[model samples]
Target chain A: MNAAVEIDVKSEAEAFLIAEARLLDAGRFDEWLALFAEDGFYWVPAAPGQSDPLNHLSILYEDKSVLGMRVRRLGHPRVYSAQPAPRTAHLVGNVTAAPGAEPGVDCEVRSTVMMAEYRPGQAADRRLWAGQQTHKLRRTPEGWRIVLKRVDLIDCDAVHGILAVPI
Target chain B: MPDSIAPDALRRLVLPDRVHRSLYTDPAIFDLEMTRIFGRCWLFLAHESQIRAPGDFVRARLGREDVIVVRARDGRIRALVNRCTHRGAQVCQAERGNTAGFACPYHAWTFGLDGALNSVPHRQSLPPDFDLKDPRLALAAVPRVESYRGFVFGSLAPGGESLVEHLGPIAAVIDNVVDRAPDGEIEQAGGVARQEYRGNWKLHHENANDTLHPGFVHESSVSAARGDPRDYAAPAYDGHQTHTQMLSNGFGVREWQSLSLTGFPAGHSYMGGFYRGGVLSPDRDDPVWREYRARLVARHGEEKTARVLGEDRFNNLLYPNVSINAQYQQIRVVTPLAVDRTRVTAFCFRLKGAPEALFHRAVRFLTNLSSPASMILSDDIEIFERVQGGLANSEPEWLDQSRGLGADRTEAGGRTVSAGLSELPHRAQYAAWLRYMTAAA
Candidate 1:
């Protein structure tokens, strides 16, 4: 195994992730877009330890353009499913930076997050979603930008009802 | 009728044009269904790929009875009731796994992969005449287990008819899915989306082949995707309009064109959205789809391949519980929990030996269709729940189903064909239900 990563390398990545979760929780999606590198991906694997996104099914698998479309749709006034949006509170912990896998990457931060959501409706149902998250960041000219963010949910194997908003 | 349900009243509840609400809301009927319908039918066990190796297993429930399908040391597949002989506790808890044998955590009772009793807590504690060889002392195997083209099925009933015969013409639905793979094999090897709906299970069965609700229920999602809202301001038509103009037009998919419904014996049917067209494919320009078509042409030749790939069907139902969408590479099944609760699982199948993108497309369909997270399917789920809630009003005793009746023409092998927005599939299902309820098992 590789030696423990430097604290400087680890802290910046940790801060970026915590701030990213805050952005999502606050619904500041416009600023959230700026945090990503030109080439970035958001993915949620369907199976445990699923390596091939191309061959396997995932709850959400999107490249940059698809992500743009999804963000646009989430903002659409007429989008029925996201009408009265569900709000999420994220608890992100265990942030640690791993050696970069990309040729020109800054660092990869691996963290675990427990998200509880409340969707506004007659029933006002509450759901708890817990998952492991990984973010690959690149040092852009402006600052560090996300190259990838992957969420591996514990119950991704179980059937989920409508996922109205982004996870 | 309000006090108690006589066995004879089951037939009266299912009138040609409508069915009574009690059929959905009654706890007694649900219990009877567990025995008369689900117990006798050839229920799906496991895909052959899921249990490819010896000691491989997948656990599923047949009705409320927990069952496990396992591949044994002898390379044979078998299903056994999961209740341990010692105390009726479930023997296995994991959904799917590989193990040489099952060890019950309750009492340490172990059984071979084929469900033969292997060990007990202490031999000396047993009575002198106690025999380990009794089948009851071991895990009880299903009365009959059969597989057709690698699709395993098991029946709780002792014996009556063969599995293939039970499937009848609906077996073609399975053939359609497997044959679409350039190679003759398909894998439901991808992930399954399991979801629960707070509605009666029959709602999904009826909705699986429903061509009536797409334009109304899914209009908003369609507008977001296709940017067309031609009929958005139109007054909603009153309930019960037969021979109505095609509502599927607003959905903006080729498969949502002129409807074609064909019903078969044993409640099997396939519903196509178009009378005639190329298959509902939007990826003619994609390199992945092109390569996939070429492989099909090479395997099934030009004419037959085009014929095979050109049907514009939406969904195909296989009798009591399963629904297959060959176009989307999905096999949907339901497990009813209570009179008002049901769980739906959609199995996504990938075509073997095709380009990886082909599998990716299949995954997209399986993800986009059905399940709670689906942009398209949640519309139906909401309505199903509404129906379950509405039945409590007690004003209308029957829900209307009299669409495209008297227009069906009988075809070969007890199959019937009908035109746009036919309710013949629902009739066919109830016909099978009637037979099962009254039959002398």
Candidate 2:
């Protein structure tokens, strides 16, 4: 691809990512939900490239139903952990694209994210969640939708305080 | 020298029926526990099956001390400190693996699976009087290490009761866990879920067998599962009431009074009661459950199978460390990090020959209801942290373990049980905690 075309592609991908982050920041979960493909996977590996979710564990390996359940849980006020509700600001950076595996499907884009969360009750109370994320984007009729969203947390094995929302 | 605790102050922290708040909240007491209790008690290490192969090894923490358990070429499992004797650099960094020998990243000092000093670079440069073959240069082994039914445990105390004797009546509890599999053994199958709670480690143990808190503290979960329209409710405690109102009103005074407690020596205990009529699988028609039931019955016989499967055990506290809930395939180990911080590692086990559905059910139950991400667990964690924070206040003299105090029925063994909502387990644990903390090292 030409340098100009590559720059345009990169900018477009960055815009898509920024929009997704905005949706999450605004607590527009349902709107963000629509940005994924029908068979898209939302995976947060216990370790990077965790192959099997069965024998090995994952922070999250949600399909449609599981994702739906989590979204529904977020709306439940009785979720004590969500009493005050966690506020998150997603900082996305360093977007890069790789070769596409197939035609009409753009290659994967990698980025780093730092999520700062606050809860009223926790001691040393604030957490700055850091992780590297990769998104496989496919050119849909409307625009680029996430086919796969993988999050690799820096402290995935460390005892987690509470994760009320999707990381 | 002034920082050292006087023996009298330590004695006053523990009583027969209750313990002072300092035991759980004081840093000094925590340090002493590391040296007195954790240092002396036989702590659960790792299962032998975890290192089935000749070269397999697993690294674990025994009371703030890091040790590596490796299967030697001769098939014997050896537990050795992870630290290299030369410069104290960790020999193995990985959580688990199969290796011929461990090499220190810092100096290339290598040790055999048995922790014998196998090689060191530049032996000629060493002093002529240096004795490389001396045992002191080898990796330090835990003072006492033993295995029962594939479960390995290590104790820093040089002399104590054998692992089996220390386990006492609780030995049956371990047997129940391994015997569930038709092959007459259990292996760690599904990967472990390690989570830390910012509260004292003992809180996890106390809460494990506290059947009374579930219905109340877990109201949100129970309501969500029931598909109720009402919002989730947090458990409320009425100081005037007989006991904490953590559980729903379902467990009335009469029912709480009638529950049985089986107390074994060394602080092990089991509380028996069915909370919500054991959970039924979502897919009742699945052939796996049927085959599992059949196999259980075949191996244990109808009476024993009913006892094992139907009996409700809120928590079987294996004092000092492990807690096994067979019905749920949940085993939790508490590793104390500080007075106010504990790392609780929960492992979900799979029956060796059971159906896949059985394992699936266990995963669903554990992850949905008990994992750190669960609403119920978060609530419990909140309360624990609150309690840990509150104990700093000088108001309360002692935390109550007086509930159902006089109601304990002494059985043939060292075990004792109280009503479903009784605090017998907590009291039993404190008693053992006191004994261990006070015993001469």
Candidate 3:
């Protein structure tokens, strides 16, 4: 592809990701939920290439109800972990699109992101969480919906503090 | 003997039914524990299945010391200190991976899977007599490394009971975990969740078998899971018809007193209590339970199956580190970072050859009730932190574990109490802790 054509595709993917990150950062969870297709999957693998969520585990492998509960938990006033609420800032970059396996399917995009979270009462420590994310996008009437969002955390296996909200 | 603890200091800290506050808040005591207790105990390394392939390794912590457990090419597993002897840099930084050999990031000092320093940069610069083949110069292996049914344990101490002997009556609990699988083996599955708690490590150890707190501390969770209409009725233990329901309902003094406590040697103990009302019961007709029951029957026959499955154990505290809840496929390890801070790693296992639903149920149980994010765990953390905070005060000399003391029954190699409300296990743990710490001194 020519440089201009590549830039155009990159801009489009970057815009979609920016909007998604904004919704989450702003705590507009319902708006963020609208960005997923009906059969979309949100996964944070327990380990890399964990194919079966049945036999293996995922930090998160939520289909609708589980995701809904997670979003609900973020707003749970009595959630002791969320008493002061968790603050997060997302820095997303390096969006690259690759050809989809099947024809007519939306392309796959990969990006690197760093999320810094601060939770009061838990600790004074502010952690800079970085990860590589893969998004399987599909063009829908609602612009672009995420078919799959996979997050690979740098410290997934290490001892973790409270993960009160989705990363 | 300043580096060594004084006997009077140790005595003042531990008592029959209560431990002095210093045991939880004193820096000196914490240091002593690192050398005396954790240094000598057969600390859990990693399950053998974690490093099934050659060069596969997992990093584990025995107290403050970090060690790497690697499977060698010849199929022997070795647990060695992660520190590179040349420059004292970590040889392997990754949490886990398969590698031909470990090369230190600092100087590229390479070590074999057996932890022998195989190569160093610019070997020509070294003196002719400088020997690299000496075993002493190799990554210092744990003094003792052994496995019981794939669960690996390491001890820095040179002498002690073997892994099997140390496990005592609790060995059956480990067998129960693996034997639940049709293949009679279980592997660490679904990954592990590590979390830190701002409390003494022993608090988590004690809380594992402290069945009384779950009903009260986890009342919110119990209420949530029990749902709305019955949530009000759930608080009363007497109303629940089944064991599971009553457990979730909240344990009153009378009900808690009815459970059994078995205290084994080496500080291990278990609290036996049925889940009231069967709320936590896996469906009998469920394919997973059917397979598990059949395997148990085949292995131990029908009568033994009843004894295994029907026998209720709320928590099995495995001395200084592990706590196994076999019924739930939950294993929690307490790593003491400091006198006031603890790191708990919880692993939920998948029973090999069992139905998918079985594993999912275990995941639910862990995430909903035991996870750091779980309301129950957070509440317990709050209480533990509060205890740690309260113990920091100068006034209180001892924390009580005196409940049901006079009623404890002496058993072979351990003590057992007929009633669940007994604090025999707590006392037993303190007793064992004193013995281990004092004897080592």
TM-score leader? 1
The residue ranges of model 1 lying beyond 4 angstroms of the native Cα positions read A1-23, A26-38, A72-84, A94-107, A138-145, B1-4, B227-257, B273-279, B282-286, B370-372
Q: For residues B318-404, could you state the per-residue lDDT of candidate 2 as single tens digits?
A: 888888877656777889998888887777777787876567555544554445565456777777877888888887878877777
iRMSD per prediction, in order: 7.4, 7.3, 5.8
Q: Residues A128-149, candidate 1, lDDT per residue (tens digit)?
A: 8898998888888798887888
- Using TM-score as the yardstick, the better of models 2 and 3 is 2
- Per-model TM-score on C-alpha atoms: 0.86, 0.84, 0.80
- Candidate 3, B228: how far from true, in Å? 5.8
DockQ of 1: 0.27
For model 3 the local lDDT of residue B118 reads 93
Specify the highest-DockQ model's number.
1
Regarding DockQ, does 1 or 3 come out ahead?
1
| lDDT at residue B401 of model 3 (Cα atoms) | 87
Candidate 2 lDDT (Cα, 0 to 1): 0.73
